[model samples]
Target: MPRWKTNLIVLWFGQFMATSGMSMIIPFLPSYIQELGITDPDEVAIWTSIVFAGNFLTAFLFQPLWGKLGDRYGRKIMILRSGFGMSIVVALMGFATNTWQLLILRLLNGTISGYIPASTSLVSTNTPREHIGFAMGIMQSGAVAGTILGPFIGGLLANFVPFQTIFFITGGLLCIASLLVLFLVKEKFDKKKAAKTPNISVLQGFQDLRKVPQIPALFSVTFIIQFSLLSVMPLMAIFVQGMHGNSEWLAFYVGLVSSITGFSNMIASPLLGKLSDRIGSEKILFIALLGAALTSFPQAFVNNVWQLLILRFFMGIFIGGLLPSVNSLLRKFIPEGMESRAYGFNTSALALGNMLGPITGGFISGFITIPGLFIMSSVLLTFNMLWVQKTLITRKR
Candidate 1:
């Protein structure tokens, strides 16, 4: 294989492994918390909800900083740091004796969470321009694949082994991922050019964001898209419980949903990304958002697990291109040097959504039916889709 090909594959693989490890915990976390002796469903719900928030809080705090740093220092270092740091944090979560400890580790993990940003930046920089949309879609699918597979693997492991064992497996993967990335992905620092340039800042990143009208639209859409989609993510285990099932299987079911989505996404993302490259991302955005909003309704009204699974698979098909669409759109408007920072800012928006999804989902699920959360998700996405189509994707732009 060619040297650059090796680096890209290694970079892509490293994230694929880390995300697979990290994502496993989500499906089974609520059950794990319940087993840890938190008897109250409401309290268990709150902690479970707060756990995702802990991760998002850190990502929110550091993403712009990391984005700026990636612009100045090169994205590879940030990727390396994220790979190594998350390895330790995730591994230690296995050893967490209490919910508080788990929360703290998760918070630290979020702060260090930029493996995707780093890899995306590298690939966006390195990949041939004509292939940006397709490559990013395939690369982004690594995350979706991990999310899909992690829960199932976690279900099996958590079934036989201790919950902490999941963390150990995740941590070990991350450690190996770090080694692979550091060795396989070379960072040729252009110190001479960097020295000639002014220092990059978060404010400058914002200015870059301001220059693109499409970016603000993309940023707003990114947040709302994730917010609407993930509203139910935290509550899936609880939903399984509502349907009369044990906690052990939550991972499997969640994995099932994720896997369905991931598989559908894997098939659809490249197609969608390619379509966007041929036509326009702005046009693709309206089509995808509407389909996703339409799909969220079935999850609200499903009668059985099979119904929910079918709806989720289709939903994944509809919305699978959302991530790549956002990236493709950003690439259309932003300059090359700014792709990573722009994507990082977008990821920060996703982190913001991640933070809100769990906190709000947990809080709402405590007060109302988990299914009700889907209603709000649908309503929000509908509003966002209508708003974006009317304001951003108009003929005047």
Candidate 2:
């Protein structure tokens, strides 16, 4: 195998470990907070959102700073910084004596975490253009796989271990992941060249990125894609209940229906990515969006769990291609030396979307219905497809 491919494999494992470590902690977070002594139901609810989102709030501000550093220092160093830093911060969460300590630690965790984005940036910079799609697709699959498995493993571990012990185990896994990257990944960074390169402030960097014709459009794609997809999450269980009503195995069915998307997503991402490389990312993106939009509309109208499950599975196949395609296009549009910064900003947009999606879904469900949320998502995606065609396609024409 080529050196870049070897590096890709190692980073894939690292991404999986990192994502798994993160997810494993998430299931136990609410319980951890309760254990910290907050008993008021309202206070617990409030702290839960604060603790969950605190990391993203800080990460939103810090990602560009780290990205700039990555551009100047080295992408590998950025990955190490995030991996090691997050490992220690997460481990420290186990030692928190109060909600305040835990909240602060979570904030620190977000500020330090950027391993996956750094890895993605590194792969984009190193991999050949012809194979970038395949590389990105495979990278995304690692992340998806981690997401799918992490919760199950975490739930199982939670049954047998103390919550604090789970945090320590998660931290250890992350530390090991960083060590793997340290030994296995190779980057031909030029210290002398980086030294000579002028330092660009984060705001100025965004200004520079804005000057690129394709960037704003590309960033919008990231934001909208995340927003539309995650909008379904806040009410997925409730929607399932509405369709199937109460049952002895409603939780099992809900989990199965929800997880089926990840299963199909894992299978389809790399295949579609290779297909995109053969035809074009633009063509694949267009088809994927159209398919997602079409499939999503029927979900709002499903009469039973089976219909919903089948539609969601198909939706997953289409959604799988979106991010890898978007990332691949970013690689094409971003100036050669600034891949980290571009991805950093893109990551922030993604975090923002994640923050907003559930909020938007909750709002829609309040005013209309859960099914209406699906229609709203479909409309947003359809509009995004048209926007892409106009900005990226017709402009070239």
Q: Write the per-residue lDDT of candidate 1 for residues 1-397, one digit (tens) a residue.
A: 6555676678767767766776687777877888777878678878888886788888988887887777778888888888998898888888887788888888888888888877877777776678778776777677666756676677667667878888988898888989988877876557466556666678777786788677877888889987877777877766765664665466677667655777777688778877877887777777878888888876878767788888778887777677777877677777756766787888899889878987888787656678888888888889988877776778436
Candidate 1 residue 18 C-alpha distance from true site, Å: 3.2
Indicate which candidate wins on lDDT.
2
Candidate 1: Cα lDDT at 32: 81
Model 1 spans with C-alpha error above 4 angstroms: 1-5, 187-189, 247-250, 395-397
TM-score of 2: 0.87
CA shift of 103, model 1, Å: 0.8
Across 122-194, the per-residue lDDT of candidate 2 in tens digits comes to 9998898899999999888777657544644665676678878878988898899899899989997787887
Clashing pairs in 2: none
**What lDDT score goes with residue 55 in model 2?**
67
